[model samples]
Target: MRPRFRRRNVASEGTESLGPSIPDGLWSKCPRCRELIYTREFERNHSVCPRCGYHARLTARQRIALIVDPESFVEWDAGLSPADPLQFVALGEPYPRKVAEAQERSGEREALVTGAATILGVPVGLAVAEFGFLGASMGSVFGEKFARAAERAAVEDRAFIVFASSGGARMHEGVFSLFQLPKTIVAVESLSERRLPFITVLVDPCYGGVTASFATVADLILAEPGAMIGFAGPRVIEQVTRQKLPAGFQSAEFLLQHGMIDAIVPRPRLREELAHYIRLLTNQHSASPVSFVTRQESDR
Candidate 1:
């Protein structure tokens, strides 16, 4: 006969912790469909709810990986730091400490990470907003990084791409952050003077000063499906207007219908579409003899 087996309590042994794990169907409630879905499933769909097509928030790193060519990104301004100019304190935490914590969590020194990279073999300058950092608000560093990226693109004769996802200007930084709006705008204007193509990819929850500035100045604006692109949030608008906002107000689809966005690109197609647009705008085909023939025929 087999020896008597002993059953050990895994929890007591610290081999495993005992708790009620969230079920596969209990992750999120879709605002549009009123259905709950597994978080894993939602992520698998690139944060689009399978049932309602609702877009979920994405981190800056994730956005960069999804859009740029694999292993092609080299970050810029990774050492620039945010200053607590106002020395603001909230909930017993200093603003600088909050920024440090955000950096730790996001592995980014600032809310925006600007860099030079190749997307589909086309060299371009890219900036992605880290929404995890104080809602990806624009501070002095964010402005400086953007301006530097734009300047770099112009100097290198490359295109510029920006992924804008933000709540607004950083409230903790006060007016200094607000000044970034004009600063970034001027940088983008410099790109225009160089005749370099500037593409803006609007992610979910892109709003406020960002929407009013660099996000709006791109030569080609692409918005993720179901993203929210607006100056003010729905709740704030509703409260100010004293009326209930319509469903899907400020959504990417809504903005596309209103001519605010050039295209509503699905996540999977974004990279290819962006590459194609960059190739076209940069006249990549012009370097080929075949393209010259095609151009001549078209002119005829």
Candidate 2:
């Protein structure tokens, strides 16, 4: 007969249990400061760590809700989804399967979310990248959505704004992904033909082809505190050049000091600042600040 083993219970064996177990996800550790913070408080603060001021990434919906006027957003290109033209496979997993997994994980059809919305009563075209969706990689559908949104903004004569967070272009799509670089650049140019303002807010971990293309070619470029904005990450650059980089390399503050970005706007002040810029850029600054401030404060 085969020998049988029995599992032992620590409680029955007289080992003391640590008090009632704490539930999972009740607290989140700050990546920068390594402090445990209550999840509710973290969400209330817009995902910025209270201790170290780390601006955690937000879901696309959360970002839209934070930036746009309540119930004012109407999405576009909702049916557009990614396709595997190359029939690509990685480590025996098909591209379509990967995309399906990403869709399930992110609860979004594609990485890019484009829509029309009002900010502080001023209409604008908006696009926010969902990093949870395949690192917000720019694939064909991603490019199409952005191009269409830009075209719509130009046609409607509204300022266009984008909150960009990406790990660059999708490698699964191969060369088709690289096609988006110039395509989006042309789209931005179309906006300029109508003299519409194009603004981009670069969030954390924005790099690769997206940054190389349209993310930087804006009327104004703003970044959150400590965002990593660059074509190649510091690690790759250091590896290539075989040299040590300066402290804070590729950070938003570093980019700002180097004149790559216009301003570093904290998350709380972002809406007001964007409204101020929109009003100034579009020559619509005649509105009284008292009414606007009151409305904004009440909403907050």
Q: Mark the regions of model 1 whose C-alpha exceeds 4 Å error after superposition.
A: 1-52, 286-300
Off by over 4 Å in 2: 1-24, 286-300
As for candidate 2, its clashing pairs are none
Candidate 2 displacement at residue 263 in angstroms: 0.2
Location of the lowest summed lDDT over 10 successive residues in candidate 2: 1-10
Whole-model lDDT values for every prediction: 0.83, 0.87
lDDT of 2 by residue, 168-209 (tens): 889999999999999999998879998889999999879999
Q: What is the TM-score of each candidate against the true structure?
A: 0.81, 0.87
- For residue 272, give model 2's deviation from the true position in Å: 1.0
